[model samples]
Target: MQQIDIDNHHLNFQLELQYARARQRQRRRNIILIVFAIMSIFYVFIQPNQYGNKQNQIQYSQTNGTNGAINITETNSTLLQIQKHFEILEKLLISQFQGKWTDTQLTSNELAEANFYKTSYQNRFQIQLHLKLIEGQFLEDYYNQFSFYLNSSQLVLPLEDNNFVFENVRGSYRRSSVYENDQSSLEIFANLTMRLNNINMDSDTQDDIGIELDVRYTLDSETFSFNCNLNIINIDSKAIIYSTIVSVLGVIQFISCLKLMKDFINENRMASQFSLIIFVFLMIYDGYLGIVHFFLALQSEYFLTPAFLELVLFFFLELKLAKHIWQERFINLQDNLNLRRELYRFHLKFYLLAIVVVLLLYYLIYYNVFLIAMNLYLLPQIIHVAYKGQYVEFDKIFVFGLLSTRLFIPIYYRGCPYNILHAQVSYLTVTIIILLFAAQVVLYYYQCKIGPRFFLPKWLRPKSHEYFIEQPIDGECAICISQLTEMPTESQLDNKFIAKIISQNQNKLMETPCGHHFHSICLTKWMNVKLNCPTCRSVLPPLI
Candidate 1:
């Protein structure tokens, strides 16, 4: 046998060794990103604006311990409380949407206050070229406030019937385990049928029908919001355009999710969970769309067709993911947990909150930075991938789907010449936004191919896991029992064939920390069943 030129072994696999355990750190980073994503999403969902960090306690009539029951008087009292809540909610809604015309007269005190505000602003803010930038900012607010105050008093929107006919009100009661007797919370919900008179504003007559109020209240916080959805009255082109755009985006998003789901159909445990969570997120979005369309239908008779059709489609559309999750959990049961029913319930709960958000923040339809923010959401993921120094199986479909979904609404309103709102957007701004999106996508693509840290200097990258394994030392292979000291002739050892084997087997050979060497494929097969070396029985680190 010809002695192998082990010293001169310049095979690609021999040049650098990548340990599987190091990949685990990359996976751990991925996990942290997932958790951060979840928590950020949840925070947005709850939107708990902690009011001055103050907690108010409310007393509820105690449930009888003997029977776990409530008193009739207590129930009636709760109804009275809900009625009072509705009255308060009605007042709050009137303040937000009730726009005042320039012709409207201000109260004597209000006029006096406006005059004082103007005089104070003029005295404080002399327009000099001085650099009090932060202080100068307040001048704009003051001027705008004075101007608005002079332009209006209250619009004085009255109720349709002037009575609290609360059609529905339900509440969930939870007592704090730590302070069960003293601190309890009541999350109350109410549905009321009501309409405000005279909603026309700025010479733009918008005939709105009755509004649907979904009030959320916490007795402990003494906080409540009308959180109502105002029905669109007349069938208009804008409504049609907006609905169509959203529906089309949903189709794109759903299709991409299905494509991603395809990657999860295998026996990979982590992949299954990630895919399921993504599917659940889609369900939540579907629920939000359902709310939006439902409101659209309520606002216009012409919109009823699109609205109902969407719902019908959604009914069937959910089946695809539902069936996938079901099969994964029951038919082809794997150890990776898939709580299908729980996830469905989770989506439902989020869907309910989404409806509340849509109602309360209908201004988001026209946008308030939220739409633009969506396009930049990938920044966090991009940063995470770079920090992890790994390519974690991202795909083009999902990336572009997210980009398209986020950009569609904004692009339609800003880019379309014949937009329903007839708003003129700067063509340059739209172009810049598109270019920015393109740049981000390109950077991400580059990262996926040549590691996430491609932008970072090469020396900073982790090289500890990598070792020059093809040292000029003679050794014997434990698994193949081949002469590690021999190098065959070009015809016998074919460079192309050697490279193919290395690629297929991750690495042609692996070096254990305890000075053991084996064929990479052979060691991998062993690690799947046990974590000890075949020859040394030394504890082997697990692969990522």
Candidate 2:
């Protein structure tokens, strides 16, 4: 094809086009920022503030004249609230966790002495219990001689970061073991599990974080002790394996997405389907995983690297891949306004459905049901292939990566009893889960092979479209023939023929499915407005 004669075309047209596009992009960015700001304001105002009490923390600054701290009462008030909450927590824990834990039994002689002391003088009863508590794996805090800590769990200090925060609730209870030692006290241990809901494999109910504390206190001093020696159910060694798998998977995905993007960029004719449905699902998937990893990075021993990598991967995957596809495939399609809107709606609707509905159902329902929800992300891609009735080449690593990425959790959760994340599954449950995911993969395979409408009724099938793109042809464009064949301008002549050699060649051509050829540029413009052969009026097909 002949080169486009830059001299004949007004430079202003190119500059104006560039300027218009820049304006459009700027307008879009502004709208996005505005919407984001509004949403952020709404979230800030509407959402309950977890750090409200923290924000109310009292600051002591000296007054110039008096050389005394101002508003000392504010500091007192906060401290009082915290202390009250701690007292309440101590009481509640003591009630649930008695002094003589089932695991630690007193000798017959000791029990007799304790009972006798309780009958004679109730005050000595608590002192004996505190001694026993200390003997039974509880240790006095090195810094504070009066306070003690459980060997099993770390001390839960209010200032330290933790998953759950203890807050003040009204109406405290002073009930205790009725023994004495009012001067003694025990306090919060941080790395404690309250066992919100008993997680049983057979049970359909989900797990929750509950406050299961064993507290004991006298009238003067509240004593709170964690169940240390009883059962230290720390998360398993399998977590390291899980984190390792995640790291590997994240790296693979990162490389895969980068390679696919590179390939697509090199092959400028990007006429294959890039399913927004799958793309958005992946973004959501990565987003949630990234968030989970973020927390893990802070807390877990093995998760830091994977968590950081996953977060980086998600941003990279979404920002680069989504932007490229959006810019090249959607934004560049100048004439397909309705199709663009429809695709946008499709993308948005699925986004809402995936996040709100799928997540809600997954949480509300049984994991067995929701486990399949993870695998169902591919259904939209299937729909796209079906609607188009054309087998578009999809990224194999990406398709399989979805499967591999989801595999580790289900397998470890269901199969390994030692797994900290989830449970021991029945063979049937495992089979069902594997089959559900495998079914999606298999169905996708068939969709690619036998066409997406293999299972559909013949009447519902989309009409076959042959674009003759398999064999792109060559010739001059009829629609733009006058412009192409017009007399060469002085500027055009001056630019190319300076070497005194004829350099202009025929224009690049494209072919219709009906075997008619036209300039590639001209046909692209013509097809945008009218999907028909220019000479024979044969129907044209949609381009990806």
Best by TM-score: 2
Assess the local accuracy of residue 380 in candidate 1 as a C-alpha lDDT between 0 and 100: 59
**Tens-digit lDDT track of model 2 for 1-544:** 1335564365667678879986896687567556644644454346443222444433211221222112223366555544443322222221112122321232211010000011112221110012122221111111111222221012133332122232211112221121222333433222233322232333322223133333332223534432422222333244577788878877777777777677667853242455655666666666666666545543244665565565555555555566555554443344657756856875677567667844764464335456555556667777866665444444576677643565665655555533443232334445666776677777877776555567799787656444323333334456766443332222232212221212222233456678676654455545543455787776677432
Q: Mind giving the per-residue lDDT tens digits that candidate 1 earns over 1-544?
A: 2335554454434444334544675586567546644544444355443211124312221321222222333355554554343333223221112111121121111010101011112223111000000101211111011111110011111223332333223333332221113234343432333344344323233445333323333344565333333343233555666767666666666676556556545533223222333443344445555555554443333344344433433444443554465454343323324655655765587567656655644555444244454346456557756554433444666578744465665676656533434333334436656777777778877765555576877687555332125553457767667655543222222223333334554534567767787655555544433456678776655443
Assess candidate 2 and give its TM-score to the true structure.
0.46
List pairs with backbone clashes in candidate 1.
Answer: 4-485, 4-486, 4-487, 7-472
Q: What is the lDDT of residue 224 in candidate 2?
A: 44
- The Cα local distance difference test for each model comes to 0.42, 0.45
